[model samples]
Target: MPPRYSYWTIILNGTATSFRSATRDELIPTLYQLKKLDPKAVLKWFARGRLWESPSEARAAAQQRRSRTRTGAKETSRDRNWRPGGTHRDPKARTAERKKVTRGHRTNSERGRPKGGKVH
Candidate 1:
């Protein structure tokens, strides 16, 4: 009896198919040959969610996906006014906002004699 572990589930030509391979290493070359023989036979790595022309491409894509996931990127913005590559204080916008805040600025005592008509 053949080992059940030899069976691999794969997507080919947009259809789910299965083939028994002695090892994943062996299956990669077979998929390469199949795609070469038939353009419609788009060999896909369902585990990684991508189509592959060769084993090297599949390996590279998987590595890239792993690198991106490990980069600690935020899935959603949890901050207000958030832009991809900007900080809270933009130079041009920062200077413009500063002028407004300072133009009419007053300190506590400067705000009007401590608010009770008394100057100590």
Candidate 2:
């Protein structure tokens, strides 16, 4: 069958998933029928392309996004809360944060380490 609506971003059980649906009002029942969510569950949508598992999650996501745009900070505690086995603070990504890890790299001797002491 043809799509009932353009598209919808859905957040359920602390995760974000999307599908085409007729409208927000019709999406819930469709979710229920599809076995994607419980019929009594409620989702909060911050905008057309954003959905959250809860109102608080929605607020937190929005706040994080706003802070990123406002201060241009390189990183934030809120932004790295979700990573595969991490907490459900973010619904979009399930991988490690986008920072480089110095797994086996050697550091210059003059950077801040004692000559013979292990670096933190």
Candidate 3:
């Protein structure tokens, strides 16, 4: 059986084309071929919470999603030692750290008191 991974559908010259259990890597070349054969061919795939109308769009969204979720290669030593709101802060650097620190219930101290007494 072919890898049951990414699924795609293409409409070209009024003919609908699809494959069974085809992986993303397998379908990418087909997408390029279809595009070359007919520029009007529509490539559709389910990705990023919606149906993407083109392979390029799907690939860009997938790449962005991967970059957000994946870690390490983009990091520098400064990033590892950085803190939120600090002089060396880089928002993307300590995302997980910031999330961890902000998780769970917040206390009055953490929220900071008003200048005067409590509000009515």
Against the true structure, whose lDDT is highest? 3
Each candidate structure's TM-score, on Cα atoms with residue i matched to residue i, is 0.31, 0.27, 0.28
lDDT per residue, candidate 2, 73-96, as tens digits?
Answer: 655454545555546566533333
What number of backbone clashes does candidate 1 have, counting pairs of residues 3 or more apart or in separate chains?
Answer: 0
**Location of the lowest summed lDDT over 10 successive residues in candidate 1:** 42-51
List where candidate 1 sits over 4 angstroms from the true fold: 1-13, 20-39, 42-45, 77-120
TM-score of 3: 0.28
Evaluation by TM-score, superior candidate among 1 and 3: 1
**Which candidate comes out best when scored by TM-score?**
1
How does residue 10 of candidate 3 score in lDDT?
A: 65
Measured with C-alpha atoms, the lDDT of residue 94 in candidate 2 is 30
| Candidate 1 local distance difference test against the native | 0.59
Per-residue CA lDDT of candidate 3, range 1-104, in tens? Answer: 55434556665776667542234566667768878978887656654445566557889987986886686455444547566565866657578768768886
RMSD of each: 9.1, 15.6, 14.6
